[model samples]
Target: MYEDFASTLAATMWTDFDETPEREGPTAEITDIDSFVIDGNFPWTIITLETDQGVTGIGEAYPSPGVHEIVTDYLRPVLVGENPLDVERLYNLMRESLSGRGSQWGVGTIAISGVEIALWDAAGKILDQPIYQLLGGKTRDEVRVYADCHAGEAMVSSAEEGQEETTYEPEAYARAARLAVEDGFDAVKFDLDVPSGRDIDTLSRHFDPPEIEHKRSVVEAVTEEVGDDAEVAVDLHWNFSPETAERLCEAIEPYDLAWVEDPLPPENTDAMRELKRSTNVTLLTGENRYGRHGFRDLIEEQAVDFLAPDVPKTGGIAETKKIADMAEAYYQALIPHNIGSPVATVATAHVGATVPNFVALEYHAREVPWWDDLVARDDPLIQNGRLTVPDGPGLGIELDWDVVDEHRKTRS
Candidate 1:
């Protein structure tokens, strides 16, 4: 079945290339391709495939510009003529070939994510089953999802910023958080930062003042309205001084946050370990991270209670699962980061299916209304705050190619 689908996909992509010759080129072409933006206007590259079996799959290359080029110019040749159903082998080939290119981070991993997801999507079509079926079957019918209202258009630029910085008022966040629970989500996440200073002493207050107080107030409001049944997580965004992380954790302890994410920068395992020592609240890390090795040092140091690597950033599905498994051994839960498109959410769901230690997955739904237009799906993989992994083959969603071309952004 995959054989037919691969042939079909190859032929269709060729037709797409021929019809839209301007869109074809090596990954380098991506350098010339325009950046594709939507809703929150986060730039992304959409990896699409039209299978011979009359099915299509979509994947995402996110958080970076020019990632499509990485997929097209850097990884396409290896992938174009290959079996889309051979998801694991194809992923390994890319990993081995691009080992030197921050194999588990940045553009390289993001590119791999696109290809891997495309393959998964293709396979699902081939087998007439969802991607999760290929990953040791689903452990649960519905994967739990958390509403991520931390910062939507507030932090990112939907339109160009003017002279002054945007003020994301506390009430705006509180409103977003409260609405998330009202919208039937069981959990919500918000953004917090470590304090910054002109000098070292001022650093102690990095997580202080307006940001801290404002954030705390937001969490408290949401927690109060939603009560104990609801969960809340704080994304520190890795701006913390270790001392500040510990201090902030103490301050937010009463809220009973589901976890405090990325208390320290990804590189400082020692700082994370130290912060964990004094804090009893749950610690989360790994979204700004990479492969199993990215978590190895942190795991070895016993730094966190939850490992939240984005599959796209951590060498795609398989690699992120490997990291999740490692975390499981250490009694840690794997709550993946899903700030990208629906394609990424599906890819991450496949991994969450196989990992027993899985907790909840992030769904930045506030912007979903805008981003959903990018995909062609009858029913969202998620419903009623739980993602129901499509039982159909490969990431199980189709791409509206017209949308990609419409939103394309070129930089080079």
Candidate 2:
């Protein structure tokens, strides 16, 4: 299917290029590409693409190791000297050039995703338009966001020493949900894979009866605490077997969760389909998946209720829009999984605004106090748990290089 789509798209591009007249002056070309790793709740890999025309665009890769290296060492070669305005062409170029590597998935796609976002940003600025306008047009002025509340209190990264671990008590979950609701989020999510009191074998991926009851207690407490104030979702982090996932889904069916995310591992579509059939809970998983091809089976089989592709990890702006288009055909909602800085968040918003089936974008940095500080905008990017799609050129936000430098992680 993708091959046919690519062939059609290539033919269209060739026709468009053939009809175009030759330009007189110098064209905007990519001059250099650089990447940085910032130490936040996670190590965020940020990329910057500079054009010969003096327009520089910024982007963020999903938090992961070696993303910066992949960007500088691999993707940079294909991107430099190319026209950043030809975003789709350049994106395909990057992928095809790295076919021998892991470009189809993993850190390879992650690095390319960041550079691809930077290309769009640069292209938007070069064309004096917002990314949504470039894609098609806006479906709405604002994009809804869901707060990723994690567990009790704010979670401290494991890199931070001498910090107390998050509590897993049901009351703690309730308190966290209440806090998110009071902070003006209409929707919230928490981790359901936290440690339960009883565990016979952690590696077995099977939940004992007592463990199931404990998870149920947490879900019940959170729902009861929030009541009608907010909708809730839970993330299992792909830590359970299909049988355990079915049991967990059945136990929480009465709580009216918005969705159960990544209940089982992402690779097994057959198992995911079976689990979805056996339960009434809404299922959403795609953050681990990459690009439109990565989500083909999940959408075609109707394995889950929602598609949650992480923009930076999946395939950046243009690629995610393609993924969303595919989901729309199947009547699925696009709730992007976001864990990067404001760069990726706003980029995802641009795509969200253009897609009709966009439900909401995830805001995973509520715990990162300086998250908003990373952007150089006068107003906060997120207000009342929603993002107003930027009308300014490109991604509609600028980076505070000073803040970026402060948070940058130094490698030995």
Candidate 3:
């Protein structure tokens, strides 16, 4: 068991900065990305787990400011000397061990998530096989993917570098969707919300009309181009109320949409179920969900037609698999929500490939050019819109330490 293997899990904080700018494709031109990322300071605190038998696993927590102290001060002690293989035991122990109530949903989940992921990585390393192979020996070889071509432009300079030129109009969006299909992707997801708001932080945003109109127009354009052959998804970023979402769904119902993602806030299953009951369009939610327990209410109640959980935020591999299984029991499709680094994408691909009931994975269509450089691999694992799982043990691909070191932000 992971609990008994003393050397199985160990954690260290690793930060990698973007050598290039991470762009927004069709979303808002909010100032938050600038306020936080102007200095090329994309700080992600990653944890590494090593086993007594000389195997290692890598996992990431929710990247945030001050993440180093949070990991070192709080999570490291709980994991430093524990067995990496005893995954379930450690998960339960850490759940009780963390401070404060409802810690499992916020930073607390993030802390334990890193530990759990590292353990999974270590287990794969120990078994000398890829992570998916260890997880019931991959049911499918390739994981289907959808291009999130919503990447507008890399924030290489400042947001004030003569203000961004709006190139991603409705025509441009449709063209991009076509190009994604040309490149072998069978599906694509585009955000139909205008990049409005002055203070567009992660959780808060002020509504604007021009932005919404622009977003709706963009969606209309993409729908015109892609037609029905491809699986097209639209993400609302939890901006609308149920009524607004319903109206939007009715407006776009003519497009034969594959799904409407995160139409309303994720926590409100009743609202989602209500919307689902009303809309002929497929309703989707669950990007902000945590664990299996967290998803149980949504699943049992039949909140939405699709379940999209992020890998890193939802307690890593094992917990995400469980969530998928639960979704399967309910006959809900599993479309993972991923919008981060390559490691997170690969981890998500593992789960998606092995699981029986899967829809598709999200990738920053515009971000590939920017994010591909971060990894050491030559060609990306993606081929023809399907990511071929790596053959090596653990997560398979290794981060370019030199590249990471060069772009590493000093914790000052």
Return the top candidate by TM-score. Answer: 2
By TM-score, is 1 or 3 better? 3
Which prediction has more favorable lDDT, 1 or 2?
Answer: 2
TM-score for each predicted model, relative to the true structure: 0.80, 0.91, 0.80
Write candidate 1's Cα lDDT for 224-309 as tens digits.
76776568788877777877667777878988889988877788788788888899898988887777877898777788888888
Report the lDDT tens digits of candidate 3 across residue range 347-367. 888888689998788875243
Instruction: Count clashes in each candidate, considering only residues at least 3 apart in sequence or on different chains.
Output: 22, 0, 13
Scored by lDDT, the top model is 2
Q: How accurate locally, in lDDT, is each candidate?
A: 0.67, 0.85, 0.67
- Which TM-score value belongs to model 3? 0.80
Which residue ranges in model 3 land beyond 4 Å of their true spot? 1-43, 51-53, 99-102, 151-168, 195-216, 368-370
Q: For candidate 2, lDDT tens digit of each residue in 147-205? A: 99876445333113454444788877777777778778899999999887664786889
Candidate 2 global lDDT? 0.85
Better candidate number, 2 or 3, judged by TM-score: 2
Ranking by TM-score: 2, 3, 1
Better of 2 and 3 by lDDT: 2
